[model samples]
Structures are given as structure tokens and as C-alpha cells.
Target: MNSVSTDLIIQSIYETLYMVSVSLLIGTLIGVPLGILLVITRANGIKPKRIFFTLLNGVINIVRSVPFIILLVAITPLTRLIAGQTYGSTAAIVPLVVYIAPFIARLVENSVLEVGPGIIELAKSLGASTFQTIRYFLMPEALGSLVLTMTTATIGLIGATAMAGTIGGGGIGSLAITYGYERFNTFVIILTVIILIIIVQIIQGIGNRLAKKLRHE
Candidate 1:
């Protein structure tokens, strides 16, 4: 029984990792630039654009406002179009990306904003173009905060994805909800919690180390 439980734990952890990885990859690709745009086009930003900012901000808010579970069910057609099915880890990735992308975008925008306006001003004084400022000054200085943001976003998304399991997305959460909770299996419930905790700790530790490494001050 112990061996079997161990096997299940390993499998669930792997699925969780898969969901996290895919969501992070896709989210970062979309979110980072969206975040940069948010920062750059704000009222006091380097290239302020009132209408653009308002439109983009509204879109981000709309995405962020929807709950993950409902988002999961709501995007079933999209999930099916992308993954060819609306149940399992692959299908879950769609909603996971949809949910986490806006969150990550906001996180990254805030982190970049926190880098202080002086850095951008310095770059501009040095005859740097807007692109050059972002490429060299902003991104490099904000690296530490970005790492922390990504770490936090990744962990938060993992928890959200686990909830996706309750809707047929495969992971430790699905295992806990479907088999453990529904069947009233104490062993499975405890095991799922242990695995989720371990994974979160590992991710948090790595993120902290990376953030420290990126810090120049």
C-alpha cells in the first residue's frame, strides 16, 4: 500500500510540474511584454497612451476577475480546440494559461514599476532610446523582483491548476478531490497535501536563490 501510494504521489507531482511549466512558459511569453507595455504606456510612463492603456487595462482586469474553476469550465471549447479534448492535464493547460497570464502580467508590471523611475531617467539622460532604456536599464535592474514575481505567480498558478483537477484536469488536486475526498480516503488526502507542500517549498527555495543571484545591490 505504501509503495502504491508513493507511486501515485510521484505521478501526481509530475503532472503538477507539467501544468506549472506549460502555464509559466506561455504566460511569461505573453505576460512579460504585456507587462512592459502596461508600464511604458501608463500616464507617467515613458510612452504614455491613454486609450491604449485603458483598453489593455480593461482586458487584463476582465481576465483576472474570473474565477479559475469557472474559467476552466468556460474555456472548454478553447481547450478542446487547442488540446483536442476538454479533460486531463493537456486540456487544463489552456485555462491555466488563460488564468495565470493576466496575473503574471500584473505582477511583472508592478515589479518593473518598483524599479524606480530614476533608472529610466538616467538612461534617457545618457541618450538612450526607449528600447535601449527598457532593454538595458529597466529589465536588468528589475531582474530580482521579476524572479520573485515569477516564482510567486508560478506557485499560485499551481494551486489554481490543482483546482482544475476537480473539473477533470489530472494532478494531485484531482486525485485528492476525486479519489480522496469523494471516496473519503484519508490516506490519499494526506498524501496529496504532503506532495503539494513539498513541490511548493522546492519552487520557492529555487526562486529565492535565483532572485538573490540576480541582485546587484
Candidate 2:
């Protein structure tokens, strides 16, 4: 039983990583652009478009407001369509991406907003194109903050993946439910909690280091 428990725990860690990493990658790719658009379409943005911003903002808000567990079940059909049968770690990535993308977008928007208005004005005064300003000035200035934002989003993804496990999306969460709770194995529950803590600490530590490095550079 000890050997089996160890093997299950190890496999669960890999499954959790698989879901979180792929979801985070896709979410960041889509969310970052959406976030940039959100910022640049606002009243004081580089090219304000009130109607467009309002619609987009509404969509983002609606999606983000939904709880992850509800979203997971709500999107199961879509997930099946995408992954050709939902349940495993790969299938779980579909909803995880959907759940995290808007969150990442909002985080990114806030990060970019932290870049001062003065810097934007300075870029404008120099006749910088919108792309040039964002690429050179805004994004670079906010890189450190963005790193922290990604870290926060990644942490959220971790939690979401655990919830995904309830629906046969195998991970440490499923292990906890099956072995820890169902079988009344306190050791398994304790181990799962410790493992989760270790993963979070590692992610945070790396994010902190990267943010510090970017800020210094």
C-alpha cells in the first residue's frame, strides 16, 4: 500500500502539472492580447472605442464571475467536442484554459495600468506609434508586474486543476478524494496538502526571482 500510494502521488503530480502548464500557456497567449486590447480601447486609451471596450469587458466579466467548478461542468460538452471525450488531464486543460484566460487578461490589464500615465504621454510626445509605445515602453515597464500577474494566474490554475479532479480529471485532488477521504487515509490527505504547498512555494519562488531580475534589468 505504501508503494502504491507513492506511485499514485507521483503520477498525480505529473497529471496536475500537465493540466496547469498547458492551460497556463494557452491562457497567457490569448489573455495577454485581450488585456492589451482592453487597456487600449478604454476612454483614455491609445485608440478609445467605447462600444468595443464595453462589449469585450462585459464578456470578460461574465466569464470570470463563474465559479471554476461550475464552469468545469458547464463546459463539459464543449470539452468533449474539443478533446473528443472529456475526463483526463488533457481534456481538463480545455476548461482550465477557459477558466484562467479571463483571469489572466484582467491581471495583465492591471499590470499594464500600473505603468504611469506620464510614460505613455512621453511616448506619445515622441511620436511613437501605438505598437511601438506598447512594445518598447509599456510592456517593458510592466514586465515585472506581469511576471507577478502570471504567477498569480498560475496559482489559480493549480487550484482549478484540483477541482477538475472531482470529475475524473485525475490529479492529486482525485487521489485525495479517493484514497484520503473515501478510504479514511489521513496520511494521504496530509501528503497531498504538503505536496500542494511545495508546488505553490516553488512557483512563487521562481516568479519572485524572475520579477526581481526583470526589474533589475
Candidate 3:
């Protein structure tokens, strides 16, 4: 029984890592730029455009507001289209990306916002182009915060991957449900929780150390 449980745990861990890493990489590609755009085009921003900002902000808010489980069920068509099936770790990446992109955008937006406005002023005084302003003054200043923000996003993805198991997403959460819940296997449930906690702790520890180093340097 212990050997069987170990095998299930190992497979689930791989699936969870696959779903989270792939989805997060894709989400970051979309979200980070979107976040920079949100800051650059907002009211009093480097390139403020009221209509553009409002439209973009509204769209992000709409997506971000929906619960993940609903988002999972709601985007089944998209999942099938992208993954060619709707019941595995790969299929789960679609909704996970959709879910995390806006979330990462918001967190990134906040991180960039926390940068001192004086940096913007300094950039302007130096005749920096908008691109230069963001590249040099804004992003560098906010990078440490961005690291922490990404850490939070990564942790969120872990939980979401577990949740993704609900739809046969094939991760730790699926193991818990299939054996722990259905078969009343207390040991599996406890082990799954412990594994998740350890993963979270490692991610958080790395994030904190990196962020601190970034900030110090």
C-alpha cells in the first residue's frame, strides 16, 4: 500500500509541475507586458490614453473576477481547441493560463506602481523615451517586488493545479480525490497536504532569498 501511494504521489507531482510551469511561463509572457501597458497608459501615465486604459482594465477585471472552478468549466471549448482533449495536465494549462495571466497582470501592476513616481519624473527630465523610461526607470526599480509578486503567483498556480484535478487535470489534487476522498484513505490525504506544503515552502523560500538579493544589489 505504501509503495502504491508513493507511485501515485510521484506521478501527481510531475503533472502538477508540468501544469504550473507551462501555464506560468505562458501567463507571464502575456501578463508582464499587459501590466506594463496598464501602468504606461493609465491616467497620468507616461502615455495616458483614457479610452484604451479603461477598455483594457475592464477586460482584465472581468476575467479576474470569475472563480477559477467556473473559469475551468466555462473555457472548456478553448481547452479542447488548444489541448485537443479536456481532461489532462496539458488541457488544464489552457484555463490555468487564462486564470493566471490577469492575476499576474494585477500583481505586476501593483509592483510597478509601488516604484517611486520620482523615477518617472527623473526619466522625463533626462529626455528619456517612453520605452527607455519603462526599461530603465520603472522595471529595474520594481524588479525585486516583481520577484516576490511572481512567487505569490507561483504559489497560486500550485493550488490551482490541485484544483485543476477536479476535471481530471491529473495532479496531486486528483490523487487526493481519487484515493483519499473516494476510498477514505486518510494516509493519502495527509501525505498530499504535506507534499503541497513542502512545495509551497520551497518556492517561497527561494522567492524571498532572490527578492532580498535583488533588492540589496
TM-score of 2: 0.96
- RMSDs, each prediction? 1.6, 1.4, 1.3
Models 1 onward score TM values of 0.95, 0.96, 0.96
Worst 10 residues of 1 by lDDT: 1-10
| lDDT per residue as tens, model 2, 94-136 | 9999999999999999999999999999999999999999999
Which residue pairs in candidate 3 have backbone atoms (N, alpha carbon, C) closer than 3 angstroms, thus clashing? none
Candidate closest to the true structure, highest lDDT: 3
Q: Candidate 3 regions off by >4 Å?
A: 2-4
Clashes of each: 0, 0, 0
Model 1 over residues 40-63: C-alpha lDDT tens digits?
999999999999999999999999
Off by over 4 Å in 2: 1-4
lDDT of 3: 0.92
lDDT (Cα, tens digit) per residue for candidate 3, span 31-123: 999999999999989999999999999999999999999999999999999999998788899999999999999999999999888889999
Rank list by lDDT: 3, 2, 1
